[model samples]
Target: MAPLKTLLLVVVVLLPVANACQPPRTLHVPVFHRDALFPPPPSAKRGSLLRQRLAADAARYASLVDATGRLHSPVFSGIPFESGEYFALVGVGTPSTKAMLVIDTGSDLVWLQCSPCRHCYAQKGQVFDPRRSSTYRRVPCSSPQCRALRFPGCDSGGSGGGCRYMVAYGDGSSSTGDLATDKLAFANYTYINNVTLGCGRDNEGLFDSAAGLLGVGRGKISISTQVAPAYGNVFEYCLGDRTSRSTHSSYLVFGRTPELTSTAFTALLSNPRRPSLYYVDMAGFSVGGERVTGFSNASLALDPATGRGGVVVDSGTAISRFARDAYAALRDAFDARAHAAGMRKLAGEYSVFDACYDLRGRPAASAPPIVLHFAGGADMALPPENYFLPMDGGRRRASSYRCLGFEAADDGLSVIGNVQQQGFRVVFDVEKERIGFAPNGCTS
Candidate 1:
């Protein structure tokens, strides 16, 4: 057989690019719920998918808290891959081989499962082979990209070889490989060349069937930061209804879009300890137009000294989480309104949700409106579907139950998950350091 490197050098022609006056001002990529990775079997239980997701959510919350505890450590650790709920199709390399990558706003490194498995987990598609791409190049140890990694390593052969990366998650899942760069392309025909990435050769985890992760966090090496210059450090995303199998396609957009405009804007908080995570000021919450009392600014404020307490807007976690006390207050207020509205509370189990209601005979109006009160005047009015997630996976039968999607976090940091973010265009303006919420923004 020919030498591996020489054999992969076969010339292949590619189509000419359309008249490029620079890539589009914004690029749109379709995103989907993790359940879309594969079709369920005929005998699969209707609620099994959601039940498993909620179990993963619990583990995800635990991992998030553990990751925060090691904030000052040199290791780059984060939530488990099995905890990821949404994914987007991404293209990489010269010819742009497509792969399904978890769209994560929580981490900093962008990596994918590569060819030559050294203990690779089973994935839906063929692993990405860097040798097939003409533009593929290994990042050297001396390069700044390698230095940016929190857990960067040098090739065992010495400093002359490619830089190495080892990312270990809280659940013991890890990806170790050489740091490299290639063309990162989108479906819109726009592409960014020489984008740094990890070509994982030794990988293991409960990543499901997805190829890898696409980090869009605020770290220097994150895709959002690396592509910030061209896109003006602005991007927006709107998650579709995850409970519906026939829902419209969700989107992850880079750069400004007409739908990103929102009347309500909140100042982005910063925690020097964990700068990669998006922080927000959550003043309080309301159920059925009545403001839930007992939650003060300190209840959700970021601790300047410890950098521990605060709220985060994350895309990977399945359910929104809040501080225990704060959650109890919110739950009580919701229960009061639910009782007054004639909605019957169920003693049955539904994931971590303590407030489950059987709305079979109750009118739609009986379900109270839940609103998030931010520091600014922005009042995010969540639709019934956003907060009252259907207990059944995709079944909307009259016998089904809807549960409050919020849960109590084990730690101080509260996370607003994708479930609550559905149907709203969430704009992350890194340049201005503000986050915007536009209602009914998932038109596409």
Candidate 2:
């Protein structure tokens, strides 16, 4: 017979081994609206807020256009973006420096303003200081990690050579500094140690008070890639409806998700040049179940040699953008439908959106539902609210403006904007190279 003392010793010895082999806990970061930014902005009127966001969107898209170009040309090492609607709170470093950074699906590098900044932007929360972090380490140019970067140039060469990167956006914003490895912790307290990221020193941009950006793009150097093993290379976010006044809890969850029955899927196309962006084989689009012809060129094709066509799922940009011909066709169709339904067309262009309707005397512009028919039969249907913005934002005529939330791209590219992504759970399955769309996807 085994004694009680012998049993206790065996159990104690096995416990440590079991814990070591166990996977880290799943990270759940609550993604809230940018309006909750710390230090806050000067309270502006609703109209002013809308205009500000629109202007920021233009700047961000311009940067994205330039980023894709830079990727093919190999002229730049880093790209910086200015604005985003959702910001995630992540704790980085050994002691942990909580940073409020914009969540961007377009760019690949997770960067933040660091200390000893010769130049810096006005950031709200505490600026992350690498020196304060016990686990901080810089990736040298000669190392494999440094070589993996899109733009890797070593200011200090060797095994310990510091990998320095310089990224300039099309909008005149830039971030330049060292590529480093640090402990990246999420709100869950669990963390991935020695995660690679950009520690920005000299930087200039219109980023309002937020520390930096959290890059969740499709690239080897992206934050998502670095943390892949911990979560099986998967991440999904459920964006709340921005039109709602009462803020509900929305979130970004790491690791695998249950196969949602209502979810639709489309394969992610291959793009060697600008692989960071999520490219889907978008077959066509339809308004009121009627397909608009002659705008086929507007749908960007997934071709490596061309590097021109194809669309990306961008969470950074607010409105959707399609190639010129496609945008024109879409606008014409929407306007025709709205006019037929008794929506008074406003004169001239309202910002970047062309289909501005006077919803003063009319009920909310109930344009027919638009559906995005992706490759492999995944149809993503968007309500009228996804493509149109109510100036007043309520039934009781609060403001006299309503504009289409879609835009025309300078290049023949298409972007599924956040507005169109509202009230749905958009899943980026990087491992399988496919995207999933579930109706009314929400996360806490």
Candidate 3:
């Protein structure tokens, strides 16, 4: 017994020394959600075609609630249209709803033209009423968040405190109302309760069918920032395209993910132009497995006057647009590959690439990979889907054609939209200067 006791004492003493000699363990961050965070699947009967379309639209509007819990980029229809901008909707509050509301980012409030409006649009969902909800509380005008909205000069003079304000968009869309809180439910595991939002009146634009604009951009009062202080400052979202309605979804991850660090794609810090915004380093664009040149050393240009870098990674735009030189090189390479495939040149100077043909009616598997080269000699290989879609332009309207086009932009930056950024897990880290891309697909 005495010998055993002495041996245990020696083991305990050596344990601390052994731990001290070992290197510190690195902290692991998670990339994807292991469990659903929002409400369980709704048992309501399948919605009508209209209802299905609205739900589909909502999924397409990808948003990121930040560390502050403010929402950014309320995507609509998979297109990243400006928020706080006003648009008309057919239905708003009624079963056959139609109404107009301003889409905003800087403001969390989402309200519609209601009660006694001469030309009000209809809405599909129940209108939010502060008086009806016991949890509703108007924000005081004196709050810093309210003051930020004062800049665009759209404030409509209300009792200001907590989370409320009238806001406008760059396109002259405006809304007036008291700011309040509400619940935001995403199809994924994201349930944001007590989220600051706008409740407005007298909205315009009566053709839009959406319930209202979701304020998901980076702003002081946006959904992500406002909720972060209370609910761990993290939000996630998934966006789906029109074609893959049921199975397709994309996510917007706030803060950091433990699973991303191990990805093969290198992560680079975003440029510090918009302090709140994040961007990923685009490596390069490729055609048919061949690496296109000239974009290797591309540096995002910062507009000193605007304090924002024009380069953007958008999942909304349908095509990849670039400056003149970059566009010419990419277009030419694709045309060359098409000509080699025995495709006749069209009157519009379009060449068909044989590589675009496959027994499956898709690009052949043997076709070269369309690679995008990055600054560090890194490359992102895009699948055929990234470049070709059902061709719609020219006299060949209904006829199927596969080709690429480039549009010149005044801004000296390249845009990598959803059409091009497919097949990779793009992680946007706003706090850090890095955007990480992993060679994985949402399907995988």
Candidate 4:
């Protein structure tokens, strides 16, 4: 009996030391495609889902390329939340209220619909009421978080002189409310205190039924930046196949992971004029072992002065887009190779894809492989499904048609959208200023 008592005392003392020596564990939040949130009715047509997604992708790309309508905030400008692709569930306030938020990498500012709304859009579940949370507090106008706003506002009531914010999106969606801090909790019970966010009183847009938007852009006010101190200045995401709907889920990871060790890294470029977007140096491209002609590295170079003529990696846009001339070259090369492989081309454009193939009788394996070459010899060899998106042929077969998943931009600014990034673990190490990619990372 005395020996057992001594052993118990030893364990009680050693447990604290063991826990103290343990390293920080990474937090993984499940991410779902927007389609998974509100699935189409059973009566919906076969090709309707793909068509709707393509249309939304076009709107998102247009918003990114427009670069107009810059708001008072450094984080605002052409952020079309209506066309956002993925979303995640988050908990707000002290009691932890669940809210579904769109996961966007194009803009900054984490905001959500709050109670006592003047004009709020329809959202699922209950709206976050700060009054119910003990930890909720409105930020003062003189606070550092308020001053961080590019253009801060003071309320008309001026009762307590609290800081206010107004953000406008390219698609006419706007959110106006008080800047406040509260406890933010994730699904794994990982919570952060004193996190600054917008409690939108008046909000409206094509947000579908989401509670709000979660921005992971490069701005200082971005969620990624706000949590950087505790989680490290690193974040990563692995987008699963959207067609699978809710059956499979990838993670939006915060902090370091074992997968980073094997990833191929490239220098993350930045444009001082437009600092919120992630830019990269693209060397060129290849189609079936043949180098594409016409466009050079100089063509894809970023003009720092104007913040134009560069490539951006975005998770909101569904399909990748290149400069008009560069895209023409890539399309022609891909078409030539596809034709040589005995694939028949369909006339006219299918949504945003121009080079579509009639895959009624053809196997998906026959499609040529496409590779994107970035700086530092980091090449992303895309699988057939990554570059070729299959569509439903209605009453016939779902895989009867497949289209090239790349598009041409009106301007020189090219975008690498989510379609090309599926199945790869894309790491944004902001502190190190480098982006890393590891193939087949979703399985982990």
Candidate 2, poorest ten consecutive residues by summed lDDT: 1-10
Compose the digit string of candidate 1's lDDT tens values, residues 1-444. 000000001101111111212678777677877555555666666476556556666655665666434321111113222333677788888677888887777777888999976877777777899999998889888777777788789887677778999887555667889899888778567777777789999987666677888888778777777666566677888887665574346788888776444547898888888777788889889888888987666868899799888988887776788888899899889888888877778875566788988776765545789999898787789888788766664545635577887888657788888778888888888778888888888774
| Candidate 2 per-residue C-alpha lDDT over 1-444 given as tens digits, one digit per residue, 9 for 90 to 100 | 000000001111211110111345456777766654332245545654565567777666666666346521011112122233677788888799999877778777778899989898877678999999998888777765566666776874455568887777665667888888787777645666667788999988666566787878766666666566556567888877664433455678777877789999999776777777788988877887788676765455755677766788878777788877887887788777777877788777665667777765665646656888898999998876777676633434546457777788766557787778877888888789789988778742
Query: Candidate order by lDDT, highest to lowest?
Result: 4, 1, 2, 3
Q: Where's the lowest-lDDT run of ten residues in candidate 1? A: 1-10
| Candidate 1 structure, TM-score to reference | 0.89
lDDT of 4: 0.72
lDDT of each: 0.72, 0.68, 0.39, 0.72
Alpha carbon deviation, residue 38, candidate 2 (Å):
5.7
lDDT tens digits, residues 1-444, model 4?
000000001111211010111224665667877556666578765566566656656656656656652421211112222233667778888798988877777776778999989998777678999999998888887666676665688776563589998877555667899998777777556776666788999987656577887778777677777666556767999888766765365778878777545688888998876677788888889999988998666678899878778988888776788887788889999999989988888888876678988765888877888889899998888888888888664634546678888888776778887778888889988879988888887886
**Stretches > 4 Å off in candidate 3:** 1-124, 150-176, 185-193, 227-238, 247-276, 294-300, 303-310, 349-368, 376-378, 393-399
For candidate 4, the clash count comes to: 0
Instruction: Give each prediction's root-mean-square deviation over alpha carbons.
Output: 7.5, 9.6, 14.8, 9.8
lDDT of model number 1: 0.72
Model 4 Cα RMSD, Å?
9.8
